[model samples]
Target: GRPPEGMWLPETAVDLETLDIMAELGIKFTILAPRQAHKVRKIGQKSWQDVSDGRIDPTTPYRLNLASGRTITLFFYDGPISRALAFEDLLERGENLVARLMSAFSEDRTWPQPVHVATDGETYGHHHSHGDMALAWSFP
Candidate 1:
């Protein structure tokens, strides 16, 4: 098998030092919670717009430059949708899951967007009954 290009941090927790270490190790990307992002700016731009309030646009990945002169891509998952799937029983029905997932897309954006949902694996068989089935059905 090929080596991993990304890593998932425990509990989605992160710090700059850890990120720098990951970049040093050749890890190209990692997923994070929306609240983890303090600010963002376009690639190669200097200005960073604040997103510390957890209002980041979760549809696209952002680049984080490390102090070591290395950079890593950060992909923040949709917090509200992930919470809904975990706590609001969105996984109870496949249709509901599909609908909720679809709602994440913005029709106004011309660029491509990805809806990344980071939830516990147990959410399927352990947390919600038949959640595995619902998730599989949603993909089809």
Candidate 2:
């Protein structure tokens, strides 16, 4: 089968039906706020008309396999952590921030996954003064 027209929607505010539409069009995966996954009740269910319970699991990613057999993997960003790093003055000093962030996951020593930090691109410029420079200096 041929691929359908590709379109990008900002904010990606989509429901189950929207996902179904995308699946029908052959969309493989999409990044969206975890809130969007709220409507997902058992696996393989469709219809975004249902409301979510407002609880989101951030450890693993969620997948929605459409009738077409094409799977859409959804990753729920850590809204609280991202917002804190962006809006709050938590990570004022880049070195301190990096140390704290690294120390958080390093406690286990056995943990295999690497620790990471993600935030709005503008956070470096708009939120914190010299934030970009701080990040650059803190890294390596």
The prediction achieving the highest TM-score against the true structure is 1
Q: RMSDs, each prediction?
A: 1.1, 6.2
What's the lDDT for residue 5 in model 2? 41
What TM-score does each of the candidates earn? Answer: 0.95, 0.59
> On a 0 to 100 scale, what is the lDDT of residue 136 in model 2?
77
Clashes of each: 0, 1
Q: Per-residue lDDT for 1-140 in model 2, tens only?
A: 97644434466577777778786776665656545565555455565544365355444456776675666666555555556678776557777667655544533444353333457678886878877776777776
For each candidate, what is the lDDT?
A: 0.93, 0.60
Residue 69, model 1: Cα distance from true site in angstroms: 0.5
- Which tens-of-lDDT digit does each residue in 13-105 have in candidate 1? 889999999999989999999998888898777998999999999998898878889999999999999999999989889999999999999
- lDDT score for candidate 2 against the true structure: 0.60
| TM-score computed on alpha carbons, candidate 2 | 0.59
